[model samples]
Target: MNDHDYYRAFLHAVWHDRSADPLVASLLAQPAFAVYRNTIFKGCVDALAANYPAVQRLVGAQWFQGAALAYARRNMPQDASLIAYGDGFAAFLSGLEEASELPYLAGVAALDRCWTEAHLAADDAALDAAALHAALAAGQDVRLVPHAAARWRWEPAHPAYSIWSANREAVETPDELAWRAEGALLTRPVGEVRWQGIGPGACRFLDACGDGAGVAASAALALEAEPGLDVAAMLGALLQAGAFTSFH
Candidate 1:
């Protein structure tokens, strides 16, 4: 094989298999090879920890580092940009036997990943709430468009939103609310990623908006999903949160 092919194979083995390829086995004896391997692996681990802070916080540093390294060994970054790494980490964690006890841990990691993505997403000008209201009053048929950076849908299988929020404050979650299913909405309305827990109705409404539905149609969908939901209040809350980038 050519030098480039050999090197690529070697790196794949070191990063994904956590071992030296037979072709590069001789180099493994060199201290520098070990150092290089450790450095690359550690970089992946650190990136994961940074991106999934809530997961790390829940599992504790040492445990998280171990888990991170394990995940790194199994999943190499698809892109060279470490910032975009760990897209499948939550799924990886969900499959781990070690994380079986904490089923919600994976969901928390997913939220943290969503937060990272929202933070790094491209900027967009949010539609002004007053202007949207004016358009509605004028009887214009406008559909609210979510910002490019918005993560308006994050409905985890487990009740992880509470755990993620609590991790931000380093506080213990109340037992009663710890495992209650929750949803989250993330948006970068003003250059800062902001997130909040959303109810089933609001989540449904946001989903409809994301699908390019108008305010009235989205509210109807929300009401269909949750009969007693206050559609007007939910729309107001979404508007106040700067969830829309423009009205179409």
Candidate 2:
């Protein structure tokens, strides 16, 4: 095999194999192989832990580490890069019978996935209120585009965010009774990712934008989806969240 092909194979074996393959053993001694193996495993564990902090909190550190190791062994990421690892983790959690008792766990995983997506998505200019007002004054039918990095989803649990926030230090089970499926928006504004729970109207509006609807059409859809929804308030919140890019 060519050098490139040989290196690729070595990487595959190092990442996926619990036992060192002959190809890897020939290149590095057994001690070197063991060290490299530990490094690769620890790297995967660290990445998973960083991405799924809330999950780690839900499951204690020891259990979380065990689960993460199992997941990494079973689903070694195809790409050497860890930019978007664990994309299928939510589904994986859903399929695991052990995690079946925590129904909200999968939802939390989904939220984390969205946060990852928002973090890596392409950057865009935020729509300013002054610009929007100017466009309105010009009688132009301008349509705001939601930021490419922005994402919104509903979780069937109240205080899910609170639970996630608390998980950083203490382990507290959220009150499922008081929790309703809460909708959240994730966006990067000024280079920092922010999560905000939005009202039904704002949620519908953002969804409409994602579906390629114009501003007026999205507003109408929001109104249809939620009666007594303040369109202005929704627009202002979107603006504040830096959720929109330029208008067409």
> Which residue segments of model 2 deviate by more than 4 Å?
18-32, 78-84, 137-139, 156-159, 168-177
TM-score of each: 0.88, 0.82
Question: Each prediction's Cα lDDT score?
Answer: 0.82, 0.78
What lDDT is reached at residue 126 by model 2?
81
Among these predictions, the greatest TM-score belongs to: 1
Instruction: Please list the Cα RMSD from the true structure of every candidate, rounded to 1 decimal place.
Output: 2.5, 3.2
Return the top candidate by lDDT: 1
> Worst ten-residue run, lDDT, model 2?
160-169
| Candidate 2 residue-wise lDDT, 93-117, digit = tens | 8888888778777777777888889
Expressed as tens digits, the lDDT of each residue in 145-234 for candidate 1 is 887877755554677888888895679877788555688888887888888988888888878888888878888888897799987788
